[model samples]
Target: MDFYDKERLTALQAKEEAQWITFAPFVFQATRVLRNSGILTTVEAHRQGITLQELTEKIDLPAYGVRVLVEAGLGIGLLVLSEGKYKITKTTYFILHDELTKVNMDFTHDVCYNGMYFLEESIKNQKPEGLKVFGQWPTIYEALSTNLPDKAKKSWFAFDHFYSDYAYPEVLPHVYAFKPKRMLEIGGNTGKWSMASFAFDPDVNITIMDLPGYVEGAKGKLEELGYGHRISFHPGNVLDETQKFPQGFDAVWMSQFLDCFSDDEIVSILTRAKQALNPDGHIFILETFWDRQRFEASAFSLQQTSLYFTVMANGNSQMYDSKVFLECVKRAGLDVVEDKDYIGVSHTLLVCKPVK
Candidate 1:
């Protein structure tokens, strides 16, 4: 190779090495905690804002260990110390405490931490051992609630602020805005979507259906939102033989619900949804899709979808190519009326009607 070509190759190699060196810290869970220690620091810092000695006393940690953690956090831009006291930095505040940020820190902590440790074994065996660790997929919820209650609370708060209360207002101005008098939210967790829809369109009434426990949670949120009168709950496996829904729904909204099933199950859901819909009623589906043209998508989303599908739920759910999803809709005898991409993340709003 020429001298110029050799120089360019050396520069590229240095850049690649630097990228790995930067991200290498993230591969270890300890580094991840340090990266996101704002919450821990802020609470401790507030409790001990008087001085480092007080902070050390309040947290009940060795003074030396506290100093080490604090210093490392400062280097990582997560904590700022001035006048011999520490506080959460600006980067940490938004990243750790913001209402709308999409970071799933708890999910990262629990699921990925437990699962990634077994990545090599999983790859070798061609199966996920994380499910074995948790005993079952439903147990993930229990473990999440038990182990990381505070982080889970914040995670749900983020969901409520962004996807529930705020999303409808942001989306209503678009063309084909839906204002339905009767709506159903399948697998509606905590009734965020139902509450938002009720709030946005006063005349709209919503029913949220989910597993019994989640249904109860939804009811509580609805009551808190003062939407108890207009929102109702049905608690049962909607996919089972005993599944039943009241008739005459003007629109059915399944947000992040359908992807948790196999193609056959998805078809069954469509059929049941069709049954619940009145004439001229519509069905709205919100989920991510996979498009090969997008390189960012190719890098992560497809693999994540496959892994999530394999382990998250029924071991069958996944992100489908748009064409595959459309085919499933057609097989269910639902006509695709509208499909709109939400963001570059393959999220889209699909509107469908029953084929007559």
Candidate 2:
């Protein structure tokens, strides 16, 4: 990525950035509280701005509590003080209203905050040590279906859907270009993509393969939505090296899924996909490779996301650099016949075919 090619910050700026890192946890919680406690929103409602006393009068918080948060907000760039009144900054607007930012923030707070403390342990063990904070599971995927708290589950789904759902509109036509009748979607959580596929294509049938719990949940939801007839399911742990992927689909799709696994696991999954390929059919992989992003902010967010894997998702997997991820794809005995980037928010679609 052109984003991180050079050291751009001055020495003083770099030292300040280091302090930002050092107090990151505090700032993050402070921001969340500001949003949740309606401090940010209250300031937003006052178009001109709200003074500490005025804001406290509008909300239930103690005046002192409101003052400190507003002062902190000033430093954090979430607020601006103009003539003794606190006003929402662009960052505050995004933190309060942006769907992407909201989803990411909620995910980090509700699902990842407590667990992330075990990051070092996870890295050392090469397992999801953070996952134990919720409950014991080999990985976060297992906990997602049954063990996660209500807020945590909601946040996780919101986060996952926010990332991939936006890409559906951009990807469907490209995928349907192959005009495949039957498709297999591994890691098709809640059948959202399948619903998108059905909406985009009149006659295509999809089978979602996932953990038994997710498959069952998706089936119920699809059935409720009157898509049961056109849908099928193959419930199994895709991570199990012994279990071969269900074979012979014209199109195989994975979106924001492969990055959940280590390089070897990703290769194994793709290798199976290669073996099961319909020769004329294609495999579509949609991921946000850190190096392929159009914005430095996006790249920075993704680089930070790698630690989420190292701590919460699975210790060995990460938000990968394109070169590193493609090396895994190459090892899987497939060739990227089509490479498309900038899909939806920030995703790369790699249309692969079995190496001939």
Candidate 3:
């Protein structure tokens, strides 16, 4: 209750809502079904509202199925029944048409929904037991690079890109302000940010350091874009204790990358990045810190995403609070030169210099 207004408390209502938490999983599945089964879209198509019979005929669903889903939708406030016809509500409009909602829904269903069943075990064991739903990989990153299911992989990348892609335009100016001739991008998954940097400034050369699979994928993309000569690849696992980061870069960039690691690993990686920098070099770290979010919903989304890391991704990392992340930076022999918050969506940009 530290963040809540005590005077506005409604104990009974709160208790009732708490009880309903038991039904959240069912409710989520129902919402997904309503959206995917065309019931929501069909109702939206008829702005004047549509009868149960009309919905059944139009969606090719049985009357019974239509009746149950519509009733559930009404109970969930996603639909309203007026004179025996169902109308999509304002909330339903976002659910049906919002791009963020679509990406989140698909991501939840394909990537996290089923895997979440092992959350309890994952929490108890400090391991991603839920990841067994897919295959036995230490982290989802391995599965992503190797043999992950097609739909899940698509949803995962979509979810990852949807949030970070918007921030790139804003970030490019800050990176280029340093007038870096050679920049090293760590954990450069799929090379999206590297490609963006190339587009932003054609003269700046980029070296992508990441897992071998990702390096190969990035190489293919750069080659296809005829940017093969401008970008280079260093294939290695940053988490490996003995691995040393390649040196002599003017700047290093990590976009939505460090959050994939625990605090200890973050410190280790940053320490290596510190070593890899030139005397006047800088390192840019971009992350969506839960504590730095402008909106409560953004913070809530990040908090929920921590569970995905716990149960599906790596079982150890989380969306860190800004204070905790900054402490890690300090421990790694770096000093924060600038802290810029509220960059496209919930991201915060931390510009750090090696401690001299």
Candidate 4:
């Protein structure tokens, strides 16, 4: 909340801006088409700009189609027309070339776009009604493990990895500072963090606990990386109250993991994690807490992501505020030992130890 600026718009300006909501979907698809149809890329390549005729010939679209799309793009400030030639704007260049933007765009379009239509119903039922767009699953994680479409899977993982992967290098030093010989990774999706730990120290052994499908996927990845011997796997649903977390870990890792569950569920998982740890063991949690964001844009993006969780991911989870998350940690009997922010793009690492 502190990250956003106060709205101080005039009445006329506020009304003008409000109209954008009406045509937002049209603009979204138009920009997507501009990117997908090679219009943005083609225009980017030509610093001097390209005419509609030349653009049509380059991308194999009809002149009428090119003109209409280019005009729409101009209205959106993604493109500009100067002296009868269409040029990519700086904003469009970033949209076309920025990795984060590309990943987020793909994730919104391919994964969360159509499903978001059921947002109202999902809110009403307190369940992910939008999940019907993909298949009947309580959560998207189930669909991810089972029958998610390939393109959606690609975008989903891309969005997931892009945010957390940047923080690995920065976070590795903190994890290694403990010099933990035995580490446990909760929610070890695809073993990216596990692999990082193994590479950080050959002698360190990692045990990844996650759903069966994720454990299997991590096993395959570790095997391919030749680090299978250094890592072990435990497959179980962490949300099940009857599920006992494996013990004997010097440190527990949950990178970008806790936000996937509801507040009560987070407390439950953290309590189980506390039980699984040695008396002196620590838990490292990496997440993009909305309240901890350094930039307004980061906070806004996470707010939108909360809606994705509401409509498509799970019914109740969200990109949490740090205050709420810390309350859960305290409720689960953990005390923060080290709180580091801005690790990589937008992540905060909270190092916790069991409260005495």
Tens digits of per-residue lDDT, candidate 2, 1-356, equal: 56667999999999999999998998998899899999999888989877787788887878888878788888889998878888898899899989999999998898888888888888889988888888878878888878688899999899989888789998899999999998999998889999999999989999898999899899999999999899999989887878888888999999999999999999999999876667788999999998998888899889988888888887899999999999999999889999999999999999999888
Superposed by TM-score, candidate 3 places the C-alpha of residue 207 at a distance from the truth, in angstroms, of 0.7
**Candidate no. 2 TM-score:** 0.97
Per-residue lDDT over 111-183 for candidate 1, one digit per residue giving the tens place of the 0 to 100 score = 4445545555654554455556555444334343344346544653453344434335544433127556888
- Candidate 1 Cα lDDT to native: 0.63
What is the alpha-carbon RMSD of candidate 3 to the true structure?
1.5
**After superposition, which runs of candidate 4 have C-alpha atoms over 4 Å from their true positions?**
none
Better of 1 and 3 by TM-score: 3
- Local accuracy of candidate 4 as per-residue lDDT tens digits, 1-356: 55445777799988978877788898999999999999999999999989888888999778888888898999899998899888888899789889999999999999999999999999998788888988889999988987899999999999999988899999899878988888999999989998888888878999999999899998998999898778889999998989899999999999888889999999999999999888788999999988888888998899899998999998898999899999999999999999999889999999999988
Off by over 4 Å in 1: 1-31, 37-102, 118-129, 132-166, 172-178, 292-306, 343-346
**Clash pairs, model 4 backbone:** none
Candidates in order have lDDT scores of 0.63, 0.89, 0.90, 0.90
Q: Estimate each model's TM-score.
A: 0.67, 0.97, 0.97, 0.97
Tens digits of per-residue lDDT, candidate 3, 16-90, equal: 787668788878888999998999988998989899888898877788988898898987889999999889888
Question: Tell me, what's the RMSD of every candidate?
Answer: 7.1, 1.3, 1.5, 1.3
